[model samples]
Target: MKKLINNPNHVVEEMIDGYAKAHPQHVRVLSENSRSIVTARETADGKVGVLIGGGSGHEPAFMGYVGPGMADGVAVGNIFASPPPDPILEATKAIDKGAGVIYVYGNYAGDLMNFGMAAELAELEADIQVGKVIVTDDVASAPKEEKEKRRGIAGEFFVTKVAGAASEKGYSLEDVVRVANKANDQTRTMGVGLSPCSLPQTGKPSFELEENEMEIGLGHHGEPGIEKGDLQPADQVADRLVHDILADMPLGEGEKVAVLVNGLGSTTKMELYIVFRRVEQILNEKGIQIHRSFVGDYSTSLEMGGCSVTLIKLDDELTEFVDAPADCPMYVQR
Candidate 1:
C-alpha cells in the first residue's frame, strides 16, 4: 500500500507524461492517442514497421522499446490491462511506411483480442498490411505440447529485440514475423516469487506469501505458480528454474544461448548476480556456451520480490539479429 504515486487512476497517464518528457529525444506520445507512443526518430519509407505493446507497470517495456532499431510504436494500456483497439490502430498507422507493420506482444488473451482487432482495423480501414508474432516463453505456464497456451514473460525482451532488428534490416513483414516466431520458439523462462506486490488502486497485495515460503513458476500478474514451499538458497532456486527450462528445451553440447536473469521488481542486483552466478555454473557444467548475458530488471511486476531466468537457444541467424545495434530509452545495444 505504500507507494510514491499520486491518484491511482491517474498513475498511467502521469507515468506516460513523465516518461515522454524525460526521453523526448527518443520517443513521444501519439498526438491523436494518449495511449500510444512512437519513436521520435525518422524511419525509412520501405522498412517494415515494428509495434509492441501491453499493459503498464512493466516499465521500459512496450514504450521504452520504441526507437531506432527497436519497436517503431507502442500502444500502452492501464496497469496489467490490455489497451483498446483505437490506440493500437493509431500506433499502427503512425508507424506504417508503405511496406507493412509487424506486431510483437505477449500471448495473453486480452492482448490477443485487442491486437487482433487493431490488425483488422489497420487492414480494412487504413489499407495497411499487418503481421504479428505472439510471445509464448514461460515454460512454467504450460507443457511443451501446449506452449501456445503459455504466458509470455521476460523472454519477451528477446522476441522484441529480434523483431526490431529484422524490421530495421528491411526484412519484409512476413520475414519479421517469421524470425520473431523463431525467437519465441527458441526461448524459455521460469520464475520464482518470494513476495507479493500491491496495486495502487486497491492498495492491497495481489497475493500473500509466508515469510519463509516461495512460489515456483509464478506468473507476472500474480497468477498461481505450480508449487509452493519453504524458501531455499539462491543456488537451489536457480537450479530448479534452470532444470525446468532445460528439460523443456534441451540444449546440445557446445550450443550457445543468451541468458537473462531478470528481476520482477524489487529484487536487488546483488541477489540477481548471485543467482546468475549459479546459473552460469549450471550452464557451464552442461557445456552450454553463454553467448551473451543480461542480468537486471528487464521485465517486472510492480515491486514483486522475485526473479525469472530466460534462455534463448541461439543459431547464427538469431545471433546476428540479437547483436544488431539498437537505441531506445531503457534498452540500448551496440
Candidate 2:
C-alpha cells in the first residue's frame, strides 16, 4: 500500500513518539509500549482512574482522548486489532489511583476479548478493580430485539469522552460504567463510505467500491456495508443516515441532541458541513434542539473516504459532562 511511513510494525511506536513530542504537556507516550498516559501531572491520590483502548486504525480514539478531562491512560493495538493483554494491564496499573480504574471501549469482539482478559489478569495478578463499558451503537449489527449485539461505530467517542469525564470528576468505577452505559443507551450512529483504504501492512485496500458508489452501515474495520447504493447528494445522504438512526432509537420530539458529523479519514470538511446542515434542519423539524456539535475527524479509518453521523439524546447530567472542558491533541473542548 502507499503509506507515508517508515515501517508498518513501527508505525504505532513512531506515531506515539511524535505525538508525545507534539503534546508533551498534555500527554506522554510510553516509549517502549503503545500504551500512553496523561503527562506526569494530573493524577489524583484517591480518585478513580480512567483508561480506554481498542484497535489502532480508528484514531483520535482509544488513546487520543487522554488529557485533562478525559482518560488517564490508553492501551493501543495494531491497526484494526486489539492491544495485547500486557499493554492493557500496563495501562490499568499506570493510571490506577488508589480507588480503582475503569476500562471503556467499543464492543468489538477483539477488544472485548483482550480487555476482558486483561481485567481478569489485573485482579488476579495485581489486585486492581477494573470495570468496562462496551459501546454498541450501530443498529445494523443485529435485529431490533438484539440491538445490544450490534457492533460499535463513531458513537464510541461520546461514550469514551463522557465516561472519562465522569471518572475525572471523581465518580466510582461502577458509577463511571453506569454513565458510559447510559450514554451508549441514548446514543446511535450510522455511516457511509465512498472508497476503500489500504492497510499499510497489507499493501492493499481493505475493500473496493467503484466510482460513484456508496456504502451504508460500514464499520471501522472495513467490514461489509449493509448495502451499496448510487452516490447521493450530501443532504439526501444525511437524511437517510440520520433518519435510520432516529427510527431505530425512536427518538421523539422535544429532546436535546448532541450531533456528531465525523469524517472517516478522507472525507472533506465541505461535505461534512453540507451533511451537517441537513442534520441540523432535520432535528430542528423534529423539535430536537442541537445543543452541541462536533464536525471533524474525531475518529478515522486510515484514509478511507466517507463520514458517519452520531446523535446522542442528552439529559442534564450527560450534557454537562460532555460540555466539560477537555484538552487533547486532536479533540479540544472549552
**Winning candidate number (lDDT):** 1
Q: Which window of 10 residues has the lowest lDDT sum in candidate 2? A: 31-40
Best TM-score goes to which candidate? 1
| Residue-level lDDT tens digits of model 2 in 232-313 | 9988899999988987887777888899999998899998999999999999888888989999998889888999999998
Model 1, residue 79: C-alpha shift (Å)? 0.4
Runs off by more than 4 Å, candidate 1: none
lDDT against the true structure, each candidate: 0.93, 0.84
lDDT of 1 at 92: 94
Candidate 1 lDDT, tens digit per residue, 1-334?
6999889999999999999999999998988999999999889998899999999988767678888878999999999899999999999999999988999999999999999999999999989999988999999999899999999989999999999999888898889999999999999999999999889999888788998999999999999999999999999999999999999999988999999999999999999999999999999999999999999988899999999999999999899988888999999998
lDDT of 1 at 155: 93
Runs off by more than 4 Å, candidate 2: 31-39
CA shift at 187, candidate 1, in angstroms?
Answer: 0.3
Q: Model 1, residue 65: displacement in angstroms?
A: 1.2
